[model samples]
Target: MSESSDGAKDPSAGTLYPGESPRVYRALFNIFPPYLFGGVRVRHIADDWTSVRVTYTVRPWNRNNPNRAAFGGTLYSMTDPFFGIMAYGQLGRDYRVWNTVGNIEFIAPGRGTVTAIMELSREQVDAIRDATRDGGKSITDHAAEIRDMQGNLVARASQKLYARRLRR
Candidate 1:
């Protein structure tokens, strides 16, 4: 993403670090602008994946059950975008990737910074091709977890990504 502040110099030169996905996630984040339940930032993206960290703040409107904790939906939303982004990064510049299905389980109340880590293995990418070998769309399962600042599991989500080779 363009971290360029007002009238400031552009650092990082728009180059994706080696071993990192070459897409600008923060720009993509602004495009689909989530309510940003908290001060979330894309800390690092590499190996065809990205990790975002959420900062906690007390906001009255976020309380869904009068427990005044971070809502479950907020945690789920943090994980939703990773599947698509990670898949695309692996598919490189040759395929189209979309989320076909997803399910999330809330394990605990999130009251502090949470980090969502996502990645797709080499095996998963090979499986995608094997499943779509007949030229039909293929579904590959992927999973992500949200961990609290103390490295405690807060939520887990699994999704099926639909992938297809782009027609040249």
Candidate 2:
């Protein structure tokens, strides 16, 4: 029940203990092809979380603002779609999962190569499985953040997943 600076439950505490193996993170990257941006590379992944760091190059489509910065939508789109994937991966085959809804906040223009980190807890995973098993309906909420190479917050996303226990 660790809490974040915002006073909500800390998302990374249980799923990723300190110094966990990188192999686990690599496996998570494979689960969601959508999160794998064409040029993005996963610098580190651990616990039940993954982080993708982007390397920038000059591209006409990426330049949206007068400053020749990365388009805000491009930045957000790059940051999206990973939380639900990680949540389902953590839940394993015990339940069927799908993204239901999401909300995003863009804090600053993405100027350089960026990073998106997604995480979920073991308790959250179990709750989704149990809720679906017991009530036939499960709604789970998860969050993620995108940051710049220097670790400045660039975008935040919150996701809701609808899950159901698969009938064998």
Best by TM-score: 1
Count of backbone collisions within predicted model 2: 1
In terms of lDDT, the best-performing candidate is: 1
Q: Which stretches of candidate 1 lie over 4 Å from their true place?
A: 1-23, 30-32, 35-37, 50-65
**C-alpha TM-score for every candidate:** 0.71, 0.64
Q: Please give the CA lDDT of all the candidate structures.
A: 0.62, 0.58
How many backbone clashes does every candidate have? 0, 1
- Misplaced by over 4 Å in model 2 are 1-38, 47-61, 65-67
TM-score of 1: 0.71
lDDT of 1 by residue, 1-168 (tens): 222225454333223345443346654563454545344555555634433433333356565557766677776777676666766665554567788898889898776567787766655765665565456788877888888778898788888888886565
Please list all clashing residue pairs in model 1, or write none if there are none: none
**Residues 25-47, candidate 2, lDDT per residue (tens digit)?**
55554444543543345555554
Cα lDDT for residue 1, candidate 1 = 20
